[model samples]
Target: MPLKSTLAVPITDDPSLPVVTFRFWLISFFFTALGATVQQYYFFRSSSGTYSIFFVNLVSFSLGKAMARTLSERKFTLLGQTFSLNPGPFNIKEHALIGIAVSTGAGSAYAIDILSATDLFLGYRINALGSILLIITTQCCGYGMAGLLRRYLVYPAEMVWWSNLVQVVFYNTMHNTQDFQSIRLIRGWSRMKFFWIVTVTVFLYQFIPQWLAPILVYFDWLCWIRPFDMNFWAFFSSISGGGILSLSFDWTSIGGATMYLPLSAQLCSFAGVIVNYWIILPIMWMNNYMGVKAIGKPLTTKLFYEETGLPFNIKPFLNQDYSVNETLYEQGPPANMAPMYALGFMTSFMGLAACCTHVGFFHGREIWRNWKQAVGSDQEDIHTRMMRVYPEVPQLWYAGFYLVMAVLAAVACEFYVDLRYLLPGKPIANMTFKCYGYMAMSQCNLLLSDLKLGHYMKIPPRSMFVGQIWGTVVGCFFNYLTMILIINSQRDALDGTKPDANGLWTGQRVQTFWGSGLIYGALGPARMFALDGKYWFVYYGFLIGFLGPIVLWALSKKFPQYRWWSKLNVAIFAGGLHNFPNGYAMGILVSLITALVFQWFLFRYHKAWWTRYTFILSAALDAGAAFTGLIIFLFLGGGLSPKLAVNVPSWWGNYYTPEGDNGPYLAVDRCGAANNAWTSGAEL
Candidate 1:
C-alpha cells in the first residue's frame, strides 16, 4: 500500500477552501498539551510537572499551528512549476504527524533528565521566556540532525519504511471532503465507531494493571527471589506480568546485552545476557561476599550514610537495628542488591560505548565530507547533497542571535534565584543583565548546531526550530526546581541514619538527585538506543536514528518482491519503536505477519481493516500507557516534602548511651567523640 496513493487526499480543483479556524487551533492545542504533559510526567517522573506540560504543549502546538497557517497562505514552487493551494484550517494529517513525531523524539526516557540537567547547570528557570527557548533548542537539535540525515535514512526507501505516514494519510483522506466518498466503509461515523471500539478495548486491558494491580496485587513477585519460577507463571497468567516477563524472557534468550552491533547487522544478543547473569553476576556476588570481612563497615560509618541509613538495603539495615543478630542481616541483603547494580552498570557501559563509536564514525564522515566538498572534491557526499538541496540563512547570523538570547536567559535565571554575584558584587537581585546575556548566548550556539543538522536533513526547518526551542526553554527553567522538590521529599528514604539540627534525617537527596539521574540516563538510553543501533550496525547507528525509513528505498532495489517491507518499516519507525529491542526484528516479523494477514483479508474477505487501523490502534495504545503511567507517578508514587529525615530504629547497638542508661554500650555524641563507656574497662 503506497501511502501517497492510499491516503493522499486529492487537492480540490477549486481554490475556495477556508483556512483552519481559531477554534480548531484552540481545541487541538488543549488536547496536544494534555497528551504531551501526561506523556512527559510518566516518562520523566521526577522532572516534569502537571503545569509544565500546559505551557510547553501550548507553545509547541500553537507555534506549529501558526507555522502551518503561514505556510497555507504561501505559494510553493518546485521544478519550474507552481504548487499553489490553500491547506484548510487543520491539515489534520500534517499537524498530527508533526505532533506524534515530536512526542516520540522528545517524550522518550532521557528527555526529562536532559531538560532538568540543562536547567540546573545553565540556570534557566521555569518561565515563559525560558520555556520557549528550551523547547526550541532540544527539539531543533535532535530533529535538525535527524532531518539532515533523513535523506540518507528515510528517503532511501531501502533505509527506512516510516510506517506512521500511513496513519496520517488515512485520517487526512477520511476527513477531507474531496476523498470521503472514495472509501464506502470509512465514512465519518464508521471511522469513529472503529476508533471507539479499539480505544475502549485497549483502555480496559491496559488500565487493569496500571491502576488496579499496584494497589491490589503485590509487586514482590518481581523481586529477585522468585526469579525464573515467578516469571514463568506470570507469563502464562495475565498481561500484567506478561509484559515484564516478555522483557526478561527475551533478555535471557536473546542475550540482548552484547557489545556494539553494526548497521543492518544481525547478531545474537542472548549470549551476552547469559554471560552477565550466569557468570559475571555470580562472580561479582562471590567477590563482594567473601571480601565482606575486610570491607565490612556499619551503615553509620560516614555522616552521609549514618544520616541516611543504607539507601539500597534499608530493610536489612532496619532488620539489623531490631534483630538480635545485627551483623548477619546487615551482610545478607546487601550482597544481593550488588548484583543488580553490576548488571545495570555493565549494560550501561556497553550501550554508552556503542553510542560513542556509532556517533564518532558518522560525525567523522560528515566532517570529512564537508571539508572535501568545500575544497572541491571529486564527488559530493550526503552533507554536500543536503547543503545544496536545503540551503539556509548563514550560520553566523544564527550564531549571533543565539548568543544574544542565551545571555538574556542566564541573567533571568540568576535574578530569579536572587544569586546576584552571577553579575558580580550583587547578591540579592532577581537577575542581572550580564548573566542572562551569557547563558542565552551559550545555549544558542548549542541550539544552532542542532538546527543546522536539521536543515541538512531536510526535515521541515520550521518544525525542527520550533521543537528544539520549546524543549530547551521549558527544560532549563523547571528541571532544577523539580529535582529539589523530589529530592527533599525522598530525604527519609535516602539518609543512612543521623540527627540533624532538627533531630533525625533521611538522605533521599542523593538517590533522588544524582543516583536516579545517572541510573535512569544510563538505563533509558540503553534499552532504546543500544538495541536499535544493532540493526543499523554501530558504524551507521546515527544514520538509523536520523534516517531510519530510508532503508525501505534501498531494500526495494534488490527485493522488489518485498515492496511491502518498505511500508512496514515506515509504520514501525513512525509509531515509536525505533529504539526498542527486537524493534527491528519485530518490525520485520510484524510486517510479515500483517502482510500475510492483510493479503488474506483483502483477497478473501475483501476488507481493508488491517490496512486502515493498525497504526492508529498502536499509537492509541501507546498513548494510553504513557498517560496512565504519568497519572500513577503524580498521584500515587509519592508527594513532595520540604524536610529530610529517617525515623527508623538503630541497628546493632546504639553507638550512644544516655547518662543514666547502661549495659556494655559505648556513648558517643552527635559529633562522634566518645562521651562515656558503660563498661569500666573496654578492650581498646
Candidate 2:
C-alpha cells in the first residue's frame, strides 16, 4: 500500500467553487503572509531569511487539505475525454499526494524568490508593502518566461523525474506502508510520530541558536578560534578525554569533502570558498573604512548623508554589504587571510568551462539529432515530443503581454516614488521607468534560459513555467513591498546612534538607496558591494552552488536510477547559495539526511508508503520550525528588538546589554567598538 494510504484521512473537493474564492484567497494570503512575516523577522534578526524551510511546510499542509477536497470531486479528463480512474469518489490519499507534489514546486519557488529579493535588496527588513510588490513582479515575470520556455523544457520522457518532485513522491509513498516501517525506526517513530519529533527538534534548534546563544549568531566565532589559545587547548583536551577526535569527525578536512563530489568541481568550489573567506571581503572592508578615513571623516559621517537621514554604523554591514571584500573577511573576527581575486577568477573560469564542456559533450549531439528529426528524420526531437505532451500556448502573445505589464509595473513604481522627473530642471526623462523595464527583461531572460534547460531534460514545461512565474512575481512585487514596510518599522534599529556629518538616519535607508543605485549601475559588482564587500564569498558561493548541480548531473549520467540526483542538486544548491553563515552547509546536511532516510525506506520496503510519509514528515518539521520561530521572535525576543537576547547571571548580563527591553542580547564586543553605540554617528 502507498504510505499515503496509511496516513489517509478523508476530505472533499469542490470544483464548482471559484478559483479565487474567498476561502482560497484567504488561505493563500494567510500562509504567504505568515511566511513573509517570518522571513522578514529573520532578515532583521539574523540577516538571513529562512523562507524555504518555512514555506515548504505551510504549502504542504495547506495543499494536502485542498487535494483531499479536489479528489472528492471525482472528475478526470484525459485526451479531451472524461474518464473515471476510480468508479466513485476520487481517492483522497492520491489527491493529497498530488497536492504535495504541486505545492512543493509552488512553495519552494515562492520562498526562494522571496528570500532572495529580501536578502539582496532589503537586508531582511519587514516592509510588508514593498515585499508584496517585489513578490508579485518577480512571480509574474517568472511565470511568463517559464510559459514561453516550457514547450522546450518539460514534457519529454527523459525529464520524467525532477529531483524535488521525486523526493516528495518517494517519501510520501514509502513511509506509510507496513512492510518498510522499519526505515522510520531510524528516527524511531511511525511517519506521523517522526514528523512531529523532527519538527519539534528543528524548531527548538533554530530558535535556541538564534535567540539564546551566548553571543550574536551573526558573529563568526569559529573563524576566530586561535589554535594556540588556552581555550583551544581546553577544547582539544576535552574532546580527547571524551574519546572524540575532532579530526576524525571534521568533514571539511576529511576525505568526505571529496567523497561525494566530482574531483574537478569539488576542488574548484573549495578553492572558491577559501578565496572568498580569506581574501576578497577583507580588502573590501578595509577599502570602505579607509575610504571614509581618508576623507577625514568617521565611517558614521557617511551615514547621516544617506537618503533616509540615518546613520551608517553596523546597520549597512548587516543589511546589504556583499561586496567581494565585505562578504568574506569583513563579516567575522579578524583572521590571517590570503588573496582572493585570483582564486575567484580561476574558479569562475573552471565553472564556466565545466558548464560548457558538460553541456556540449552530453547534449550537443542530442540537439543536432533532434533538429534532424524535426526536419523529418526517424528520430523525433525533444521539442516535438514535448509539444505532443503539452500543446503550446501562444507564446508570442504572452511575451507581448509580459512587455506591456512590465511597462505598467515600472510606471506604478515611479508613480509610487514620485520620481517622474530626471532632475530639478530636466524634462521627465523616464530613466527610472526605463531601468525597471530593463530589470523585467533581465528577469525574463533568466527565466527563459532555465526553462530551456528544463525542456531539454524532458520535464513538464507547464509545471516548470508555473513554478517560475509564481516565484518571479511574488519575489519582485510582494517581496519589495514587505521589505519597505519592515524597514520603515525598524527604522530605529537600522539607524545606529551616529549623526552623519550631515546628520541623517544613515542607517537602513542609506543602504537601501545606495545599494539600489549601485545595483542599477552594475548588477554583479553592485550586489557584491551591497551584500558586504565580500564579493569573493558570493563568487565562491555561486561556484559552489553550480558545482553541486554539476555533480548531480554527472551522477545521473553515470547511474540513471540516480536521476533523482539532479533534483537533489537543485534543492541543495538553492538552500545553500541563497543564505549565509553556513546556510548552504545546513541545507546540504538536512537534504542529504532526508534523502538517505527516504532512500532506505523506498528501496527496502513499501515504495508507496515512503512517498506519502516522507513529505508529511518534512512538512510537519518545517511547519513546526516556522511557527516556533515566529513565537520566539514575537514574544521571547520582545517582538524583534532583541532577537538574540538571553536571561542569565549578572556577569553574563554585564557582558551583554539588551538592544530593546528584552533581556541580555548577544554581544560580540571585540568585533568592533562602534557596535556599542545606539546611533550611526557613534561610528563616525
Candidate 3:
C-alpha cells in the first residue's frame, strides 16, 4: 500500500512458542482473579481508581519469562493428549492472554453498577448466583458481536487501531529484541534493558501517590480561591470534570493514555473538550439557561429529583409492581437533568445519528461489498495472508458465546431487578447496552492488539481467538464475585444518596451509574426532548451534533482541495462531546500536551527518538500506576474506614469532592433546603 514508517518494527516468523503452559495457566488464573478483585475492591473508594492494562502486560510478561527461564519443558500425557508444562519459551501469545484477561476489567461495566444500585438504593436482593450470571451475560454478549465483525475490524491493514500501536511496540521490542540494533546515540543498554530499568524505577516512585500523600494524584492551584461559590469552585476545583489545571500525577489517569492515542484523534478530542466543557458549560449554567442550577449537585441525579419536586424515596416507589408509577410520577413535575449529564446524553444521541450518517456515506459501500464476498479472494490482507496457514476460529464458536450470554442475560434481566413482578425489560436492555458499549469497545480494541501480536509472532488466528474468549469468560466470574463481596461489606458507605462517615467510601462512580440508570430507565432522556420540557435544548444537541459531520463531509466533497478537511473526524468530536471537560478535563489536557510534544513534534522530525523512547516511557508510567493502585488498596484506605487508615490533610487537592480520600466537604445544595452547604466546607 503506502511506504512503511521510518520507525522499524522487526517481526518474528517463528511459529513454535509456548502460549498455554503450566506457568501461563498458573499466572493467568492467579492474576486474573487478583486483577478483578483489585478492580472491584477500589470501586467504593473516593478516587477514580482502575487497574492499568499496561501494568498487567508488564507483570504478566515478567512472570511468563521467569517461568520459561526456570522451568524445564516436561512432556506428559493427560487423558490421550500429550502436553508439556513448559513448551518451548515464554511467548507473546501466552503473555497476550494474561493481558487480555486483566484488560477485561479495563472498561466501566454497568452490571456491577446495577448490583450496587439495587442493593444500595432500590434494596432489591439479587442472590449470589443471579449476580454472577448477570455479569456474564452483559459482559460476554459483546464478544459474539465482535467475533462477527472480525473480518472488518481485524483484517484490514489500514485498520491499525491506534491504541494498540503502543502495546505492539512494547511486545515487539521485548519479545523480538534481537532485531533492534543498538544505535549508540544516547543509550547505556539495549532497549529491553532500558525498558526494565525504567519500569523498576517508576514502580518505586509510585509510592508517592499510592499510600503517602494521595493528594499528589490530583493538583488544582485555584482550589484555594473562594468566597466559596460552588459554581465557581466547580469550574476550577472539581476533579471529576471541568477544570483549567488538571495535572493528574497518577500515570494511569493521564500519562499512559497520552502515549497511546493517535495524533489526529487526540487533537480533535482536545478541541471538542475545550469548546464544550470549558466554554459553553460555564456560560449556560451561569446564565441559568432553562433554570439549570446544577453546580452544588455535580453528579446531577439529586438536582434532577429536586428540580422535578421528587427526591427519590425508594421504598415508596419501588413497589412489588416494577412498572413506572405514573400516579407517583405525576405527583411532581417532570425530571430536570444537570447541564453536564444533559450534554453527555445529547452527545450520545448525536453519536447515534452521526455514526449512522458517517458510516453509511463513508464505509457503507465497502462493508456491503465485503459482506457479499464472504469467503472471496478480497478477504486477503498482508497479516491475514501470513496467518492463513493457521486455522480460522469458526463463526459457530462466537455464536456459541453469544447464545450463552443471551440466555443468561434474559434470566438475569428478569430476576436481577425483581422477583414477584420480574424486572422490566427496559432496564435490562439499558444495562446491557451500557456494559456492552464499554465492554465491546475495550475488548474489541484489545482484539486489535491481539491480532497485531499474533501477526507479529505468527500465532494462529484461531488460537488467538480461543485465548481471548476464554480469558474474558474467566475474568467475568471473579469480577462479579468481587462486586458481590464489596456490596455486602459496605452497603451504607457505597450509597451515593448518603454521606460516608469520613468520606472514605463515596461510591461516586456507582452513584453516577445508578443515576444514569434512572435517567435512561425510569426518567428517560426522551422526556427532556418534549415540547414543554425543561431541557428542550437537549434536542438541539442531537440536531446540531448530527449536522456537524454532514457539513464537514459536504465541504470536503465540494472543495476536494483541502486534504485535511476530511480528517476532521466526527467520531472523535462525538466521543469528546459525550465525555467533556468535566469527566476528564485535567487528564485530557495532560494527554493533549504529551501528544503535542512527542507525537506531533518528535514523531514528525525526531522519528528515531520518538520510536525509541515513547512506548517504553509510557509502559513505565503505566506499570508504576498499576502498582500504586494495588498498593493503595492493599495497604492504604482502599476499602477500610477512616478509623483504621490515615487520611491526607485537608488541602486544595482534596477539597474538590467529598468522595475524594482527603477531600473536604463538597459543594452540594440540599434538596429544596437552606443554601448553606457552600459555606464552612461540609458543615465542618
Best of the candidates, lDDT = 3
- TM-scores, all candidates, are 0.44, 0.53, 0.82
What's the TM for model 1?
Answer: 0.44
- What digit string (tens of lDDT, one per residue) describes model 3 on residues 399-439? 88788878877787666645332233234346545775676
Residue 447, candidate 1: alpha-carbon lDDT: 42
C-alpha lDDT (0 to 100) for residue 415 of candidate 1 = 42
Decide which is better by lDDT, 1 or 3.
Answer: 3
Q: Per-residue lDDT for 424-487 in model 1, tens only?
A: 1121111223223333444444444444333323344444444444444434334434444443
**Model 1 clash number:** 110
Q: Whose TM-score is higher: candidate 1's or candidate 2's?
A: 2
* lDDT to native, each model: 0.33, 0.37, 0.60
Per-residue lDDT, model 3, residue 21, is 65
Query: What residue runs in model 3 are displaced by over 4 Å at the alpha carbon?
Result: 1-18, 34-59, 96-108, 146-173, 180-193, 200-206, 303-311, 359-392, 415-457, 484-493, 497-506, 524-526, 557-561, 580-584, 638-684
- Expressed as tens digits, the lDDT of each residue in 1-684 for candidate 2 is 112211221112222222212223334444455555655544444223334432343344445455445544455787996643223322222323222222322322232232333333444432344434433543455446555544444332233223334333333344244453455544457654666676677676655434444232222233224322222221221110100112111111121112222333333343344333333333433453323322222111122222233332333433222222345325544211112222333344444444554455445676665444334445444344433554345687577757866765565445433233433111112223334455556655555544543343233444444444443343344334444544444445444332211111124323333333332321233333334653334355446544655675777788987444433423222322222222111112222333444555453476676544544554554456566656764566445345453344333212443332222211221122222322122222
